[model samples]
Target: MAIVELLNQDMKQAMKARDKETLSVIRMVKASMQNEAIKLQKDALSEEEELTVLARELKQRKDSLHEFEEAGREDLVSKLNTEIEIIQAYMPEQLSDEELETIVVQTIEEVQAQSKKDMGKVMSALMPKVKGKAEGSRVNQLVQKNLS
Candidate 1:
């Protein structure tokens, strides 16, 4: 099923199951997707666009989760973790560390990236291929590790 249709179905299920947290996340994601569509001058989201929105939501939750963790706010950290899980369900399967490293290596070789100076060259080529699959920060780290 398409993402929009799956989201609607899940929204109904969440309501029936009284999963408030899930319902809230779903609603927020649906709203964000709609807003993205409007920004692109469209009436609906494509599969790729839906993935982009989900990835963005996941990134935001991760950033918040880090802050909450740093402040020792275990309660908020747990809630954000749940929200991140919910958002991740709608995203493409994440690239494993090994898998991510393999791609990073390939990109480095392809771009002949010899040092940190070539970071941008490797990343520009690799990100589009890994976008929504891998984390940008992690990819950058791997690229640096491989280059130096």
Candidate 2:
């Protein structure tokens, strides 16, 4: 099923199950997908674009989770973690650290990225391959670690 349609079905299930956390997350994701479609001047997004939207949503929650952790707010942290888990259910299978490392190494060699100066070149080439499957910060860190 198209991601949007799947989301609608899940939303109904969440409502029936009285799962507030899941329902809220799904609603936010659907809204984000719609806003992205509007920005692109399209009625609907391709699966690739839907994955991008889901990745963005996951990133936002992760960043918030980090801040909550820093603030020492366990209550909020737990809630954000739950939100992250709900969002993650819709994302592509994440690349393992080893897999991501191998890809980063290959990309570095392919781009002849000798040093940090070529970070952007390597990243532009790498991001498309990793996209929704890996976190950008993790990929960038691996790239930097390999380059340096």
| Top TM-score model | 2
How many clashes in each structure? 0, 0
For 1-148, candidate 1 gives per-residue lDDT tens digits of 8888999999999999999999999999999999999999999888888888988989899999999999999999999999999888877888999999999998898988889999899999999898889888999899989989
lDDT of each: 0.92, 0.92
Residues 34-91 of candidate 2: C-alpha lDDT, one tens digit per residue = 9999999999899999999998888888899999899999999999899889888888
TM value for model 1? 0.91
Worst 10 residues of 2 by lDDT: 83-92
Candidate 2 lDDT score at position 81:
92
Taking all chains together, each candidate's TM-score versus the true structure is: 0.91, 0.91
Which window of ten consecutive residues has the lowest lDDT sum in model 1? 85-94
